[model samples]
Target chain A: MFLQKKFKEYYSRAEIGMPRRFTRREYGFMFFERQMMLRHISFSSSQKLRNFLTEKAPAHVFYSSAYYSKPYEKEMKDKEWLGADLIFDLDADHLALPENCTYERMLGIVKNETKKLLDDFLIRDFGFDDLEVVFSGSRGYHIHIYDREVLELGSRERREIVDYVTGNGVSIELMLGKDNYAVPSVSEPGWYGRIGRAIGSYTDRILSMDDEERKKELKNVKGVGDVRAERIYEGLKRLKKEPRAVNALPKEFIEHLKDRVAIESSRGEADEPVTSDIHRLIRLPTSLHGKTGFLVKPLTLEEFDDFDPLQDAVVFGDEKVSVNVLKPFSIRIKDFSCNAEEGIVEMPEYAAVFACARGFCAEE
Target chain B: MQPTILAKYPFLPEAFDLVKDESMDEILHSPAFNRARELGVARVQRALKNEDSFLFIDERNCFDVVLSFFISKAIVSQMNDSFLLRRHAIFEAKNAYHYLEEESRETADAVARSLGIKRDRNGVSFVTFLKYSPNAYGQWKLANSRLSGGMVEVDDHTFLRLVQEAVRERVEGIKFSVDGLEKTLDLGPIRAELANRKVTHRADRVELESFPPCMKSIMAQIENSINVPHQGRFSLVAFLNGIGMKEEDIMKIMAPIPDFDDRMTRYQVEHITGKEYSTPSCDTMRTYSLCFEPDGLCARIKHPMQYYEYRLHVSSKKV
Candidate 1:
């Protein structure tokens, strides 16, 4: 009753912005009559919307990209809609990082890649200075670009932008200067500049890795021996920390170097389907996570690395509640970390909320 | 506002505005712009800065990327700043000139005449003004543009200079940037219209409602277990697979083919499903005569996947 009251009270006062207005709204129930779980969906008013959230307090909330005139109509065509935001979600699973990486490492890789996406492609190249970057509060990040310019872009144009971000179409020919054979200047625009930076980072990562593995990977770069790998590694390391003339590296070396840089350049990965999907529905920010018992709150790019969702995102306070953990397991929720066999446990306010949210435990 | 006529006389305000205009320069210089197959703004810049450097013609797409963006920007305000005439042909030009009374024939003539392009006696050249052409060239050009061009007969920098010189000769670059041609454009509304408009993506499953004519024909053939040619089968499977159809679904689609070689068909379909090979592209489909009948939208799209995406886009916008 207390948890139910907490949810009802929160919704009664929680006035947050919806991503899109006049959406094809649907609320899914947790464990009630499956037949009536998502029926009579509507976009009537905040009161109606809030009522669904509290009365049923559905397990999931979904809103469409469309802004319909009469969203409750039986036929989809009846709803006269306005516009939708261009949202991109980058998840850890989508990225092809080193295989068998841990969840924490996956999140780390995704965060770095997301940062590069915002800084390099979105801001510097595409000229979107300000963007809505949201921590998915899970294993990925969501980038919502709300500029009018983006909305005008068609599917193909959007795909091309995705292509640029993912380094799919970037070519070495574009980077290498014409006629007078020269190593690519870092000052050149577009993919050339991006590749230069990627090289530095890739080299730093390579140097930090085990030398034996590095040598093997380097050998595969051109079938070069360990001597060449050691030489190339050192040269790349020196090149990373400073800039010199364009022809500083050997032509043969730069030729081989370009291929490696291309691979490194492709590290700017994103889920292509998500970015290109025009009518995608995303998790609503500030809504309590159904799985984590934490709020799906928005975070600034500055706070991206430091923000800890497990601890900082907890909404329920220190009030203790009993929950029956079905299976034997343990979990950490803020200061309350509990290990218990398959039975009931008195979890703190946050732990109980999280356990209940995940369906790992139910309130007793 | 049309800069074609003014392109000839260097001193003409329109000519300077057309070629040397900073907006033109920006678009031309943008990484997206492609003049031809390999010669783009970047490659041209590299060539120009280095006097002895020769521009390499790396063949890719055959259309100008910069022009496509220009057309989209131009239609809202100046309608004839640049010509999108097909085949440099005069009949199409005449047709386009006659269709839109508000559009200027003189402006079209001026651009063609100034560029030394010849016209037939009908006062039309194969080249006429188009927002976006209906031909295959125009379709891929628009879809893949904002890239580089193919090999030009003349030197890269010289041709670029001519195009640039036309825009920059007399117009103040900065002034042209501010008040030249785009004075009337409010992209916000354009964006809103686009957002409200339906769009497509890499669909997980095909929507039968949006199937292009060619695919429909192929499906009809397949449904009856008719013998579709190798090209037809390739096109069919690729189109089906591109839209997220499963291997089993594709096999079912292929079941009606004359030979009904399950193993062979499975191999081909799996090739695409596994991403070992991609679906036949727009050009390949056209080459095999497997291209479906024109449905008006065919002019705007190139590949079957593109058609599927466009269908989803259209449906999404349906209200």
Candidate 2:
């Protein structure tokens, strides 16, 4: 009851950012207690959306990235889709991190993945500029491209984009050549260029390792015995210059290294389904996540480098609140740090809301 | 535009503009169009049979070529068979591609421009490339192809292939208002050609194991009494119907769900099956976000029915 009131109070005061073409997008809301979403709701203006947010105080708010001719239509077909902003969702849940990684570490890793997606794939490769990056408020980040060129892409084309970023169908033979030994210049475009650089870095890493480490790495590569590994190590610099120069070594060894570079050169690992789904409802910017009570905060590309979510996303003020912590938990939000075992505790209102929202604690 | 080129590529918008003034009455009943009608039937028959015989086109018979092309489209439109329409489109596009291969680069570029293929300094627009890249060879995917400066680079052949796809889409969308024209023309031969074109599914047995990964995932959810989404339910019902499953048997499969209202379920099943709603294509499934856990075979086929049939064929062949 306290958290819901606080959320309502926050919504009433907060000047939430409206998505572009506010009237054309469909809005969806999940209330405080309900898991089911009430969607197909359209707002004509910012004030209408603000009024609904203040009145109902939805736990989570979402708006369609797709523009619809009939935004309030009940049936999918009736809602004539005009176009959609291309979205790339980089969530921690999609990453294959260690089982016991800290929350902070997971965020940091996902943040790096998000950067690679934005900088390497979207910006450098795809040449998309009109981008909006938002902290998803719970697990990861969402990068939305509002470039006019990408707006009208169908799901098949979007799927092709997904395949490109995630390196789904990159053929090593094509990258190298028909003979599997045709060394490509590093200036080659796209995956070919990336894999070429990756080979150079792989060789550099192998040469920098101490004798035992270098030997261990080479021996681990299939069909590379101690003798072949020694020869390959001797010509490592040459192999870096010309990937095809290592053919004198075991073919399996060169093939293995090529395979390694192919995997390493894959651009980004954004969630596939999210990118491919043209009518996906992305989290509304500045809305509080139902699970974490943190703001789905939008950031400028410049602010993204220095922004810390735990501090900046914590919107609630620091009033003291009492809550029964169900388990031992340690969290840092804003300037307040809480390290408490299972018991009734007094903490800042923000921490209390965060804990209670995540089901880690309950109001006393 | 040259009339000869227009006749060769009659599906072009310019060709349509020229023919827009011709009356439907002249097209249907004019004894002067007897050669056009004959050639139209031959065009559709060749498409149905997948033959490589060319429509005789020359400077002298350019008018006949243009008229025959429009007459063939009108016949297909009157038939109202999507499958036949698609086959005709592919066949026409393939023919155009073969001709484009022999044509000069300037002519090809002109045709591309006519089809709205935007090209800048980099290459063709990424939108155009992606729009037509589906069902193309593996190397044609953006992941494998050369893309730079926000455009897809293509050589003369690949560019023509893309044009072919554009032409296919244009042909597929060709709907002529021939409601009365169908009564004027004797359409017995064309009707006979369409009788065997409807896809018939093998009804030997329900091979549960042969279900595509998407269907299998939905079946698993249903068997575990997990609530499947509306898209998943529709795809599952359509797929089961496509595989010749009886209404009662499909109902038994849905019985495990907690909220499975028998009457509502049966009604939906009948509506989907009794109406003969074929399985949603793989692309449609992907668009609706129902495609789950696509596997190796998924990449090779375009539809779930094709997946099941291919799997069944392979397994049966091995046995």
Q: Which candidate leads in lDDT?
A: 2
Q: Would you list the clashing residue pairs of candidate 2?
A: none
DockQ list for all candidates: 0.04, 0.29
What's the true lDDT of residue B92 in model 2? 88
**Model 1 Cα lDDT, one tens digit per residue, B1-319:** 3333221222333434444444554553456543421232222222223222222212232123223323332332222211111111222222223322233545544443454432333221111111112211221222112211111122222222233222221121112122343343333443343334213322344689898888988899879877676557766776776665656877987887655545545745654443223556667677567876768878887777677778888897894
- Local lDDT at B86 for model 1: 11
Q: List ranges where model 2 is wrong by over 4 Å.
A: A34-36, A69-83, A98-100, A149-155, A179-181, A207-211, A227-238, A241-243, A246-255, A318-328, A338-352, A359-364, B53-59, B134-137, B177-319
Candidate 1, A1-364: lDDT as tens digits: 4455555555566765566454444322342224343533664576776676767554445555434456565543454434456667888777788977865577678878888877766665555645687767567788877765455343334555566566553444445545653334455445655556555566677788797888877778655676767777777676665544334544566656555565455446667666655445566676655555566667777777686666767777787777788866667667877776778788787777666655677668
C-alpha root-mean-square deviation, candidate 1: 17.7
TM-score of the second chain for every model: 0.36, 0.68
Off by over 4 Å in 1: A1-6, A20-44, A68-82, A96-107, A198-217, A222-260, A303-305, B1-319
Best by TM-score: 2
